[model samples]
Target: MRRTKPYFYRLLQLSIPAAMLVLAACSTTPEQTGLEPAQADEPETGLVTIVKPFPENSFHDLLVAEFAIRRQQYDLALQLYMKQAKQTGDLGVIATAARLSQFVNNEAAALQSTAHWLTLKPDAAEAHFIRATALARSRRPLEALQHMEAVIGSDQESNFATLAASALAQSEMDQQAFETAIRDLLERHPDNLNLKTGVALTLQYRNQEEEALRLIREVLTADPSNMHALLIETRVLQQLGRINEAIDRLRFAVDEYPYHKRLRLNLAQLLTRSDIFQAKAQYTVLHNQHPEDDAIRLALALVNREIGDYESAKELLRDLLARSDQRDNAHYFLGRIAEQEEAWDAAMDHYRQVSGGDQLIAALTRLAVLRSEQDGLPQARADLAAARLRFPDQDIQIYLIESDLLFEHRLYKEGFALLSGALKRHPDNTNVLYARSLFSERQKNVALMEQDLRQILSNDPDNATALNALGYSLAILTDRLNEAQTLVSKALKLRPDDPAIQDSYGWIAFRLGDLEVAENYLSRAFSQSKDHEIAAHLGEVLWRLGRREQAISVWQQGLNNKPSSTIIEETLQRLQVNLPDSE
Candidate 1:
């Protein structure tokens, strides 16, 4: 009744404790898990002692609970422990139940057990933290804050901050309530700098960025050297789209605290978007300071590669190769460098050495692509077949790559056949189905395209990609405007921030004769991505609204973004709109 399904999923996110194996060892004492058995009843006969079992906290219950735990039946174990806690009023049992409940995300159970725990040990910070977690999860943020305050009073401020972070990820209403509760607490602790920062954090989560910035400035005013406040101010400034201000703040912070690793790392990452040279300089300092840090070294290597300093990148990558954990990544990047310099043999050698890790598939794909160009398509296909046999887990991805290669060579029939075979081997695989659907569209097989997209929707009704695809296809290629509108509307609700889905929604609105709504949605989608198709749709809407000059300007901008966009060209042709050639 309390939606235990989501809690079960949350439980699965955690690694199962290795201690559960001890349940089967017979050496584990009942006190360890707090499901202690009742003492055996003995008859008064001096010669022979006959043992009797009691119903409450019986030995039988202990064995069953331990067996359940060994079998990974955590819910059963939790139930047994909860029952024992209630019957015996053992603090240990209550504590175990509380922790287990929280682990499994059973908010109600956690609250009840933590209440019992608090009753026995009123000063336990763990109990307050656990209770606060359950209360926050249950949308009782005010009550949760009280327990969080109690946790802080017990010098568990770190734990309270962790709870607050988790609370921020809750629903919008919950986030508002959490922010409001933090503000109320800040009122009580007016001079508490941590409280001020906490309010600023919650306000940022609630999207009150201006207010959050003001609060952080207040903290900075009180303590100019507050690193935490400085970090929060940078984040708030970034959220408010004032990246330069954020960069300046970080620059000042790094100047003030040159030894701060996080401050410099943040500065380096921020600079990567706007000023690559500045980013490289910051990363250089970070790398020099932390020579043993592989992540910093990798970042510096990437920065070097981006700046065309191939020799420096190669040196850093070679250094990373000494660490077994980073070997595959190192080989992958080295291969990329070789490819960039047109050293095909060296690139292939490096890629071949990437035997495992996250880069394995990428290396294999690149190796096959290069092989196809240098050797024949037959040899490349054979190599892909060998890769499938060697890495069966990557067979589907390998097949997709093969199809891409075939399509790139204009072998449409071969590519379609490859995807069809893949679909036979992996029926109802959404990725394969989606790929096949795109191919079907290219072949003008509208029915097949609809079928594949519909199959994806049937398997996963909330799949926004399939929804938008099917809806847009209907709007463009069929006379099903109403159906297209409905599908696209659902997708927009599911992924409101997705530019592709927004474009689909606008396209459907245009077909359904809602010009103003279409304009608004298309403008928003284009503003987010400047994507060619969205630009085409938006320009047409503007043209229809009798704003021909505005329409041409939008079209020109789209062309500047992507000169090879056939969609924009076709739209212009269809509308008989002639544009002057760019100077």
Candidate 2:
């Protein structure tokens, strides 16, 4: 009367005996046979046919489910498994359903399956853990915490701190809520070192450094050999900007735990940042101990490169390139080494192998330079165009590099045209504007130069390079002495130790007839940089002050440094001093 047609239809669909379905629905425990408890009292009715009908549709569904699993259709498999779990009341099927649901990221179905599993096996730690994880991800922290407590109580394999930390890490709660929850747990489990560590980690994540450090120290005090506590302490020290202290702590920890690779690796990395020699020593020992470890070998090679031991670095990189994992990086470093040695062919070969990562652009730029050196400007320009086509997002950098090549070769018109075209595409780009201004200076287009530099200043008032360039141009070529003085002074204040700015200040003083001031500034600039232009300026100042011998000595040194310095030659000829013969 209550509609047995749906039940008949389901039984037909499942192809199971009606009596077996009834037995499955009524079974209370996994060991229950086909007989329901109510039926067991009176049923010796000898219903062998009821027990014998094969679940053909369910068996076929299971086969289809396995096929789906083999094909990596986990979602469809999860649905079939969950249906089987509900029909059979089988613990194994329910657990599989829950696990498969989790695998497919079907949180709602996972929670449902895990809830049923827990109902069947109330004391199952794995079921509690799965439910807790699902609940936490679903943002039901309170329910998750209850199940987490049960998991901690039942699971003796992992400590309370570790489980709690794992839960906290996976929670979506905000910092304050996380801290509050963790603190509450800590109050309940005060002696749980793992839980304490978990709380400290949460605090650290929130940047509550002082509290985190205190808790980590407390844990270390209780268990001095605790590697986790020590690592946390080192991290806290680093966050406080006490890198040296962090290094010392790691060094001591490594000595105590001599075989602990992580501790030693941390010490080595910190040493690399502060003292390369010490880093190299540590890495050498590590490399000797772990000859099969490519990371250790790579670290040693990089340290060698940093210390200018290019031969050793090249040998290490060559050995590493024999393996496939670090081929690109090895090629990049090899290219750099070859470039240092001025072996253009060798450098290009290595750079061409470097096809990806952070060094790709740098390698390409170096390759272009080498091509220009070996072939010609036209080849370099063509290569740069190809590079731009290959890496369209890096158009700005390619344009800058090509323009720099032209400028260095004294092809002013070509450089200007390239920069003008780039500006048309990227009109507000500061680098292009700055480069164009420099090209205008070479062309002696003072108005264009001033306009470009002022445009830069309008956007970024503190651009020291533009300020110095503008000021120096006005001091040398125009009568805006006071304005030039102000601009150069501002630039000097912004970059107090810049030698170029010092030279500009000196040049301004010389133009204003302050010979002593000019000499002092020029001497400072020349002493700091040893630049040919600074040397020329100093010599001119000295010659004007009747110190002709000193001026000649300075000019000679400048000529030795830069054999073809036009500024030094012109100053010597203008002052009626004899120019030295070419060396």
Candidate 3:
């Protein structure tokens, strides 16, 4: 019995016809084109260039393959090309097959095709890069690194950043293979700045901030003017909770390398967290230096808006509308500005123009909200339904938005009906399931909430959100203290620093009669976030521990944080305690 290999990676849409045409055109040999004999000897001297041409006899199959691609039958196209490659032993056909297989995420076929391509053109940088990427994605880290090494000094070196990102993602899951592979690669290329920085980036992601910072400092010591090293060091410092130090580092780096766009942009972004005025000044400098760059202009506009310089922001946004690529972003920001100014008509007009780009969903949601206020909920919902048809890819988001609108209007039944319909259309979608679970909790349907959350957990057992939600719900709504403790403990282990998870853990501890443990966890959680829910928990735990004045102060702080917080009100009411309202 022959075993079939499953395809890996998500299937990308068919969008490589231009690339296919380039591959076909590059099939002509130097000899056939009457070029210099020295040019033809490039392959023998470890400088392999063009792929071998397809034989004339295989033209009919090639045409059929091209037709299959036109029909969006990528699998059929790849199969036909692979067959032609095997029959003719042609590098061109093998390269085509490899690319097609990779595009369709048929990693097994890609490996086979790339092996054949490499056999025919051993020094081909493109072939090596593709093979390394596939091997990395397949978790064959050692093999991937070997191929990656082949392309290090070649033109394909820049592409290694993508593979490094993949390695970092794997590292987050604590994959030993990638960790070993990076160490081995570093040992082989110890002095390579790119490799060192890439490894440091992975270390930074893994929360080994001290080690990551040390590596980045080594790079900076060797090349003090290195922009990448400076940026990475800032990130490491930021991760270590030294935001002011990070800002100061970027500020100094900016003074030294004033013309570097990325360095200045990063500095400006970092400054926004602490000093909006300073961030605006930096953006203004960047904008003046590169007036033609839409991204810089957009950043400057956003900073101006952040400083409440609405007129300046509007001017920059309106200017950006002249550029086709920035039009959607400009319209979206303009709509937001109008909304801030309470100019509903202008806001709707600008939102209407935002038909595409990342801001489309947000713009549509805001438009629906305004329409609901001006017209009616039904009209707003009808508009969203039309938007769902217009952007089928955002159907789930539209559905959720409509559900929120329903719940906002106290129409719980309509909200549930909408969620049920969404679940039918997108069966077992974890996001939809999670949303419905929260809605179910709102309606006090604990059984329904458990069913939905359990469905999500069954599919993704390590989902921290579902685990925490379920555990907290069980602790508050039912008497399953042991199970709640188990679930919440698991969630806390997964995300130990998360305030919400810590709050849940504290609540469970309090329920289990561990008041001291509850007080410690809840105090730390409230200190970290100052969230109303955490404050409520902390206040109750303090009250029970005979810290009455502290409990009142915590409850008052909670009310001051959010006067509309039902959590704080309910906690105080349940404990039969009354404090003066926050001024």
Taking the tens digit of each residue's C-alpha lDDT, what string does model 3 give over 370-418? 9999888888999999999999998988888887788677787777778
TM-score of 2: 0.57
TM of each candidate vs. truth: 0.69, 0.57, 0.75
lDDT of 3 at 71: 76
Lowest lDDT block of 10, candidate 3 = 1-10
- Model 1, residue 160: what's the lDDT? 34
Output the better candidate (2/3) by TM-score: 3
Q: Rate the local accuracy (lDDT) of all candidates.
A: 0.78, 0.75, 0.78
- Where does candidate 3 clash, by residue pair? none
For model 2, the local distance difference test gives 0.75
lDDT ranking of the models: 3, 1, 2
How does model 3 fare in lDDT?
0.78
lDDT of 1 by residue, 1-583 (tens): 0000100232211111433332223222112443211111221111111122234333345456656755778798788878876875656557767767876778989999989888878887777877887886775666777777776544444233444566676787767777777877878878777667878887776688999999889989999998878988999999999999999999988998999999999999999999999999999999999999999999999999999999999999999998998999999999999999999989988998887899998998899988988888998899888888998998888888887788667676777788899888999888888877767766767899899989999999999888888888878888898998898889889989888888888878888889999999989998898877888999999999999898998999989899987889999999998998888
| Model 2 alpha-carbon drift over 4 Å, by segment | 1-253, 259-278, 288-296, 305-312, 319-326, 340-342, 523-528, 542-564, 576-583
